[model samples]
Target: MTVGQRSGPPIPLLGVEEEFLVVDTDRGEVVPEAATVVGRARPALGTRVGGEITKLQVETRTDPCQGVDDLHGQLVEGRAAVQAAALSAGLRVIASGSPVLGRAVPPPITEGPRQDRGTATFRGLHDELAICAVHVHVEQPDRDRAVLIGNHLRQHLPALLALTANSPYWPERDTGYASWRSVTWGRWPVAGPPPFLTSARKYDEHVDMLLDAGALVDQGTIFWDLRLSTNHPTLEVRVADVPLTAAESAALAALVRALVVVAGDAVDGGDEGPELVPELLRLAYWRAARDGMGGHGVDVTTGRLLPAAALAERLVALARPALDEAGDGERVEAWLGWLAADGDGATRQRAAAALRGRLTDVVDEIVAQTAPNVPMSEESTLA
Candidate 1:
């Protein structure tokens, strides 16, 4: 393929999995209507739609696409289908870090003996989990490459979290953290940054340990923020919240695919990914979770703190070559600028709530932004 036409890593296809909360539009409260919404969406979405652990949320994933533009289209289609299906059920689908205007009570559990077992095992832990996120899956050349990509991805994953932070309000008040979902996910037994490991075998051993110790209910519960896809030949990035707009979601998916390409290239060139201390990684995660793109970010490379805008630009610079290979360098930069100026979903939510003096206004704004995206910034393109 020509330089301008080449896609990422020999046409490595990527897909997006997004989770959304089903809310009663009138009352602006999360409703346990996921099963019904997923059912209503079934004829169009088929198995693409699934219920989460709780019935207040539904998950939708796009089919793998080789092009970034194609991935964006797939994401938009998925969101539109979800919105239409949800509207038919007298509800609206809101894609936020957490459902802002509702209590934390567990909704109905999704039907399945396995799901039942999970709830039965974890009880309150599983029951209280209702956060939604957008997971990007980038095709891996093999298991070994997947592990290395996960390691390489570790340094940059917090930047991903910073850009997509959407859950600012939850648990009955403003949490003051950007991606409260990250905080909530940290409560899980096996979640957050991956440990330093060079090979896929070691990765498997770690997962096996978690399963044996019952820290994980099964392979699906591995929950390593970023992980090797258990079923597909892809490295899955699970750090981002379910963004409020199709554009934000598309921006994140493109960056993830670019990072996957960059990481794969590093592995091919026999480069070892960085080995930062887990404590540093934890602090970085905490900083990003607290501030989103509105505050300083921990520079994982040098341990120096940088403004979120500079850090975001550094990430784009690091991934520029891969982004060029994927034909999305310009698109990513444009959207990155937008995210910097506009702030993440969490910032937007807080602003809306502050203006309208009600959390329900924030919910309404989220639902509207989910469709026909309200531009986050006037400066969409960056030089």
Candidate 2:
């Protein structure tokens, strides 16, 4: 995988990891029943279903997929498996970025010795984390190239934020922001964009400093919007909130893998992009979180505000070549059209709240939307 000897075309194989909130139907709030929900689904979901740091949350991990269709189908099945399991437990799973209610309470953290130690060390910050996100992992050529991909990803981070903004309601109420999860996540000292580093050695050195300074617990806590994965040979993007629909999830996955290919090409060609200040990147992310696709976003190119929808289209254009290479261009375009018509989760949730005059209705709507299609005949196989 030498940079100079690169031949053929770039193929950034990728996969999706989605987290969901388990809610008590009677209470209309997230509940600490992930263990039950996950256990019941274990035989069906196998390794795909697991517990998150909190008992209110469960996550699904798909196998590394070489094509967008396989990745998309895996996500659909993962959601359905969890949805069916939750329903059997007299509950349901919602894909909102955070809890739907403004006055939602945090459930007890999941029972694990490691989680216990983290709670003891971080104190209240651990309690503040009831958020969930959609993480995408794209194959990398090598560790050094992975580090460069992180650098390449910074400019588009805000656009990523805008496309998948889902958390508008948090602990207090409609926070006037789209992705409250992003704001909540930023409270962590090391949880935003990665710093500028040219090589894997330098990136490792920076992470070591964060560990020594106690800014992070370990490599797992790097929490950068994008980073070289610790456990996999993929560069992972952790910036997006959990999108509600299969269309939205697949769109993000397609865009991310294409962007990785775009970056790999740039690195091989010896092209260097501008070094943006971390503060500016933070401001861009904040703007996207505040507006979703309902308003303006800070343009990463000129530091000026642009309509979020327009910027999102531009982002898709930038990655079109890579999307075409992966045979995902038509699908991504269809997703964009659907988003233009129906809006994102944040928009839909707010609309539901407004129409029914209660967040409870919003929760019900999310539940109904996430319902798995039962087999028409008992023998029908799922996708």
Candidate 3:
């Protein structure tokens, strides 16, 4: 069945999909626990968390909401539920894009058709690639806007990467990249920024051409950096890696919402900020993937190279108007400042690892930093 066009008012909404690793706390190894975790959280099953390829990973999605405040609450509740359930099942939830201590072992595919297809397809593509990510979806008024935002947002993707750079250590060693997960994920055939689709009709035509050529089974296979969701009325931005904490996740979501509102307003005003050719965008993405925040940057429109931090500053300046328009300027600035000060997740993780000399210690720090507070029950009595 063909996916229908997006239907909604111009009011922006936010949804977050966070992929987490199931870790054995004692050994610091990846373990397959989809059945155990999903079984235990049956009541909250499908409502908050769901299974992903390889039982080692699980993903939780927040219900769609109109504002960041509500979105934050959903994230907190969902994360709390998942953490409690995971702890109960002898597993711990980790927020890194790729776990540092896990060995690559293919886990059984839990019963489902789409998941089965995904597992088979990925296994055929590459081995030793079990990474997780956080995908953010924002509701678009229509498909044309979705396509436009998808293209324009490509320029700002690096800045987002700099902010959400988790997963420095990979496979028990320092990958020497801020977000190795980004590199690992790029192995997929259709991953990365998509070719510009100017309108809904153009996007549909591209999908049709791919299907006609037997390139894909359906829209589900088109894993662009940003794309219209196959089953939802939202544009999915799969750029940022999963962060280590719910606050970080919410911060990333807030940035995404701000971008959509900014881009949507620009489109509505007939101001297409600047033209970015495909090659230039690719180079920028490559640099971001390579050096992350420490890498060179590319001009969004002209493709001229610049320092990554300078480009990030320019992006923040460009986004200021939109943040102000959305009345979220303070929050956005604070979030960006945190990233700048801490130097993204990759840098911080490396620092922790270097200081502590243990990858598990780094993971423990991430968990402690990101986990939500558990309130004490009022009726509890001391033994």
Which ranges in model 3 have alpha carbons more than 4 Å from their true place?
Answer: 1-10, 44-46, 105-112, 119-123, 126-129, 271-275, 374-383
RMSD, candidate 2, Å: 4.2
Write down the TM-score of every candidate: 0.93, 0.93, 0.88
lDDT ranking from best candidate downward: 1, 2, 3
Each model's C-alpha lDDT? 0.82, 0.81, 0.72
The sequence of per-residue lDDT tens digits that candidate 2 reaches over residues 1-383 is 21112254448678888998888767577888889999988988899999988888899988988777888888888888888888777777888898875334555787777777677667778866788899999888588877877788898998898889999888537888889999989888778788888999999999999888877666887888888889899999999999977668888998998888888888878865558876677789999999988889887657898898899898899999778767789998998887789887899888888885888878766765654453222222111
Per-residue alpha-carbon lDDT of candidate 3 for residues 1-383, written as tens digits (9 for 90 to 100)? 11112332344777889888777757667778856776676576465778876677778888887666677777777766666677776666778888778675443455678765665555655454467788899887588878887767877886677667787777788877787887877777677877766788898898888767655656788877788999788889888888877777887777787677667777777664455677777777767766677667676677787877787667767777555655556776776677768777777778777875887777666655555564323221111
- Lowest lDDT sum, 10 consecutive residues, model 2, at 374-383
TM-score of 3: 0.88
Report the error of model 2 at residue 5, Å: 17
Expressed as tens digits, the lDDT of each residue in 120-152 for candidate 1 is 677777755889989998878588878987788
Instruction: Locate the minimum summed-lDDT window of 10 residues in model 3.
Output: 374-383
Residue 74, model 3, lDDT: 75
Q: In model 2, where do residues sit more than 4 Å from their true spots?
A: 1-9, 102-106, 372-383
Provide the lDDT at 34 for model 3: 58
